[model samples]
Target: MNFRIPIFSLLMIGFSQSAFAQIKEEQLILDRKREPEIKKIEKKKTSVEAEKNYPPREKKIEDSLNLRYTVTDVPAASDFKTSTIQGEDISPKFEAENLNNYFQLGMGNFGRILADGNIGTKLENEIEVGADFHVLSTSGLKKEYPWSSKQNIGNVAAYLNANGEKGKFNVIADYGLNDYNLYGIYALQPDADTDLKQRTNRFKVNGYYDFYSNEILNNVRLKTSFLGDHFNAKESQAEIRVNLSKHGVELPVGNDVVLNADLGLNLETLNTDFAILQENSSKFLNATVAPQVTFFNGDSYLMLGSDFSFLNAKNSTANTDQVQENRTYWFPKAELQFAAADEFKFYAGVTGGLQLNSFANLLETNPYLLSDQQLRPTETKYKGYVGLRGDIDQQIKYDFRAGFGKINDMVFFRANDLFDTSVSGNRAAYDYANSFSAVYDNGKVSEVKASVQYFPLANLTLDAEAQFTKYDLENYEHIYNVPLLKAGIGAKYSMLNKKLHLGANAIFSTDLTTNSFEITESGSQPNVFISTENNDDKVGGYADLNLSAEYRVHKNFSIFALGNNLLNSNYQTFKGYKVLGAQILGGVKISF
Candidate 1:
């Protein structure tokens, strides 16, 4: 069905290009009016001082003016979902489906504007609305179901920010909203069951105030903001900041030192009364107070910072159930830099936090006779990382980062322990890599390039990384190792007097980790089956290949085309999650 729609869309575009041209023209006008700041910035600046005097501002103005609209109606092929074991689940065969393979019929428009150097001057305003609708189907299912739930989701977002200088103070306010047709903090799985149908609404506001002073002994900045969302439920958070920094200051323990200090307070509340027919609704309220101090030397100097946060949470259910959870976290981050060469620089940093989550009568019995307290760990996760960076005249640059950490009271879900949660050994992950690029910036032509780095380690896991996720299910924790070496290389080149450009990228990884299941425990009843999946740290590796091209038809118009999975590779980024197979997409744009 997806493939058929794309074919139909092509025929329609050829038939009605002229009719829609006028609509595009009106949209361009509205685009400029909506983005005043963008027009101001692009008005041509003559001096560096003028640009520097411009107060710090969001980049939305610049980004909004260069918007692109895409309309594709094609059912591209999808990659098959790999099983826990390397063996294909032939009994319940899951066929490959296209990524963005479903048909799309929607209208989207975006715009932005900017302002020049001015204090107390409004900087930017932006608005955007985009939508997509598609029909997805599943042919094979392991379990019997009356029907496959329809998949439909739409999102809309807009932002506004204002900046100005009031007397000796710098002030700014920002507001925005993002609505998604999904729930939870975790990334949405394409096949995951979701009762959430409509888009979720979220609203946020942030503001900062800086009291400016040339006095070398005393300067201060104060900030406070609030964020909240209301749709299926209500969740709100607020924060405050007070900071002071001095230059060329002498302290009791040091000379020629820059001293800085900060104090903050935050409160977050989440209240939800899950509908019995839908899911369990729970309400929670949390508050915290944080304070910290940071110091940075003049240029090329050492940096140190530390802060502490305390939190309390009270949860209530529609059934008049209540629980309390408390936690305190200490976070400290530090960095150092060393010049290794006139053309090379090296820097390293380490950051992590000490966090403890405890339940004081935090759990109670539910109607299902399950102990909620057992589902959570008393001593949770405290993760950290250390990384280094090197730059060699931009032509050769690399970033290497390694992490050491785990959750003490990690949660993992199991079918057997549906109601009971067990504490798993800390699951740890460590990944480090470095990339090199052959880059050049010269008059008339310029191109930025980079190549992937190959590095490997143990004790790592891969999951949905596109967005945050949250759930009330048993904590399903697994220890997976990615000792595979991987590399990706890509570059862009411009021709036709820099009017047209082309780019391509390819990534590959070898040394596979295949899964193997074993009987961890048998059911209490004789002849009852019980088993778990084990993995082989060795097997066939996976690879991904992509290529794309762009052509500048004119100053106000351009075209782009691309193909992914050019080799039609079949693989998965993580177990159970399906990847997209070979696909192609192309579009055109017109801008003022």
Candidate 2:
């Protein structure tokens, strides 16, 4: 599950600008004339440089001591079920059972693990190596009872840095795996006979270098990365991205001052056995580039950028099934910060883009498995957005955004009725002998969001956010009228000399518009049309409540107890997805 943690700096900039606007008009005019003088005064009134640079500092070595283990049973509605079509006396049934039982073992400081501190050890020639890893797991399935599943996730990363006297360079790599297994649940079949499994892996490696050493071009940086993944198919995809960027350039470009540019090129390829089955499995290759230019004033900035992507994909799956897609995108991104007062700032930006996907990859892995399919691998889209954000005070800030977009030839999975088995002329009906289809359609989507953060005390903070999204399909066969909204609030407190930490987060989500699923025929044959008008009417949200206490017994030995899902709240963030309720576990650690 992905959680959106409201960004803090984006709000501070807006708030700082707003506060500066409160200055009197006369002061503004005089301030402009006295800008240089004010700058000189500021420089002269500064604290001692040596003292400022050598301020008090904290040591890094720490350890975790002690441990705790806690588990609980949760109650909720199940999202997955097995049913038979052909008018068989098959109906979806929900079995009541405990969902989620997991233990969290905290080693050393929770914050240290959460922050993922980089361990850099000096090697020969100013070279260094850094590594980091995090793992979290939960067991025992609850809610959508009967069909139980086990969930696990972990991330590992390592990097090597070479900082030479002339310049700096680095190479880094990361690997992540997420998997889920459902046991004793019969899917796509009748009877609790067989179980299903799903797994996904993502990995990437990147290389970067700073070309200039001691010049204005020192702000210029160039880097490239190779990213690969195997999510839908067993095959892996490899892509390369090369970027050229320059920042903090104080120069004039025509009438606009302070200009910068960022440009990048991306090349990608996919190697898989599915390509052999679909015949469309040719050496997949493509290239894309995005270039951006920005003009900045003392308090405002404007940006223009565009992305051009091209792809060459082949599917030899007879006629019509041979797939290929090429795409291009044009976008304009801009932002302007207006300081309306000395202590307040109001800022907003409008951004949108147009994209054309001439080639679409719809078939999962191998297309040859099916004898007939009718999906055109091409699409076009348009999108745009507007948002405002800023700080109300030093301790409070907020942001909101709204956007609209439309996608033409939007690919969708299409299915047919199993009984209508007239195979001729129908590619999907003849080949799969099933009633499912994936096609493209034209659709529009809109989204809105607002979030705020407030620090009530020096060591305590509160945050709340809301998001609403809507999707309108112009020509869809399987479903229609899909709209969803989400809202959430969370709080964090720092205690025990900032060593012990406690936080709680709650997220609420619901569908405003109803979606219809085609019901399957019962008994002999499966009904292809499963429709739902009122939806599941979900009303509850997931809560992430955790408390961790760490005590520094000595300079290098620290003990702590960490609790995750403290309340053991039982809820699912997505339909059919089960999350562990609560777990409390702790462990000791020795640190350098």
TM-score of each: 0.49, 0.61
lDDT of 2 by residue, 1-592 (tens): 3554444323422332343332111010000111111121122212112222221120000000001000001101111111100001101111111111111234221121221122435566656565644453444454434443544555566766555544456555766555544331212222222233444455655555544322323222222222222223334555555556565455745543665566767776654433212333333566667787766554445666766656565544433454565555454455555545423444455444332221123322212112223333333344666655555665766666677876666554333333333322332211222222445677777878776677667766667667777767766432322236666555554454654333444445453222223333454544333322333334244434433333344434444444444455544332233344444334433344
Residue by residue across 312-405, what tens digits does model 1's lDDT show?
5455544555677676766655655554453333445444443222111111000011112222222223334343333344333344344443
The Cα local distance difference test for each model comes to 0.30, 0.40
Question: Which is the leading candidate under TM-score?
Answer: 2
TM-score, cand. 2: 0.61
Model 2, stretches more than 4 Å misplaced?
1-120, 142-148, 182-193, 210-232, 245-256, 270-284, 315-321, 325-329, 333-381, 408-441, 477-483, 512-570, 573-575
Candidate 1 residues lying further than 4 Å off, grouped into runs, are 1-154, 166-267, 270-273, 276-299, 316-320, 340-350, 354-387, 406-477, 480-487, 507-541, 573-576
Error of 1 at 587 (Å): 1.5
How far does residue 210 in candidate 2 sit from its true spot (Å)?
Answer: 4.1
Q: Report the CA-based lDDT of candidate 2 relative to the real structure.
A: 0.40
